[model samples]
Target: MPVRRFVPIAAVVLVASLAACNPSATKSESDSKPAASASAGTDRDEAGSSAAPGAPAGGNGLSLSEAIAKIPAADEVRDGYKRDSFKHWIDEDGDSCSTRNEVLLAEAGRAPEQGARCALTGGEWRSYYDEVTVTAAGKLDIDHMVPLAEAWDSGASKWDADRRMRYANDLGAERSLVAVTAKTNRSKADKDPSEWMPPAQSAKCTYLADWTATKLRWKLSADERERAALETLAEGCSGTAVKYEAAP
Candidate 1:
């Protein structure tokens, strides 16, 4: 298999490793999909990163995994899942910064080793979600894999704002709104997988696994068009090593 590449974005933002996107923005009713840069969709730059442990960054495009799609939809459990149930961005420790700040450290490659107040003093970001590479952490945004409003539409409206925030700021079990190129993040704002895809064509397989796992875990599903698109992508990943579920 060919190796995958990591392409940096236009105006680079320096970081310890992963970028630390500010978490103060309010949710928009319309732009639930990832944000798109003016350059249009994802910009696949031909750069590469040292392979992370999991699966090799090369494989087939999007595809469904029985394991990932197996979770039964818990529309009932999500009944009272308001945006306020899960308190987010709070100081996980008694430190000054919030959970979001901690994520910058955990995800970024350049973050400092130890600090009481956990500020992401050092790191650099390389967003795979969008082909555009981000050097400076602040320039990028920690995008929610599934937008709030969209989640609401999918059955999160009943959830308190706190619960919504937890999902938005989820860093556990690989669930999160990770840092990615602003353009790609915007383009993926609220739309489902059926609507758009990353500019990096090589990452289709990884993207599909992540998407499928998240949707399944959250008890969410794609609408008619969205489901069809996901199913189509899954067909391409039929015989690859891509995992549809995060390991225990």
Candidate 2:
């Protein structure tokens, strides 16, 4: 893997607030899914310091094992899933850049030239899933680390439209949405670590950590096989630690 340069990007304000957006929502609706120890999300660095100006950051010191252990395990609900159920790629911030463009700009190894309407001309990106180097933004796909279909299966099926939309376009945590080659993104589709792992040998541990962090961040559930797979894979990732902020 090449040494990549990550440029800082602004934190997008997706909605006014999760509570304000959903007036009728109850505390249980917001808190019911999280495990006791992994109930919240915060963005803390390795040194366990503060987050950026507007970004929500905090401490989730759980090792990969503990993080995986806190994920609620339940049977998946796969029926009645529609790709459109979760709206994505919108410019919620009205910054001319959509959620996809924000990810592209943030993840680009070489920053792309931004034009009117956020047209990206040239940039370089490393598709971590396959470790493929891509210079064209058009060739990269913004992947939901936790696929929408997978989220729906886990626990999103019961969420209202607004909450589902937040999950789909989440920009709160860097791990939630990733930029990768379209090929690798398509290959991953909606399969979890249990069914698919990254082709890049070096990406496996980071991939597992990110996957676990994303699930815990949103308080999403896991099925038995998926939970077991995460636990089994986590043993090899002893050096990796997960830190995520609870999505508001």
The collision pairs in model 2 are 41-245, 41-246, 42-58, 42-244, 42-245, 43-57, 43-58
Q: Candidate 2 residues 1-248, lDDT tens each?
A: 01111322212111112232111123232112111111112221222233323322423245678778888889999999999999999887777888899778766767899999999999888777787888998998988989999999999999999999988877665667888889988999999999998887767776786788788778899999999999998777654545555666
- lDDT of candidate model 2 versus the reference: 0.67
Question: Which digits, one per residue and each the tens of the lDDT, describe model 1 over residues 52-73?
Answer: 2232123221224553445344
Estimated TM-score for each candidate: 0.61, 0.78
Output the worst ten-in-a-row residue range by lDDT, candidate 1. Answer: 8-17
**Candidate 2 local Cα displacement, residue 150, angstroms:** 0.4
In Å, residue 97's CA in model 2 sits off its true spot by 1.1
Candidate lDDT (C-alpha), each: 0.47, 0.67
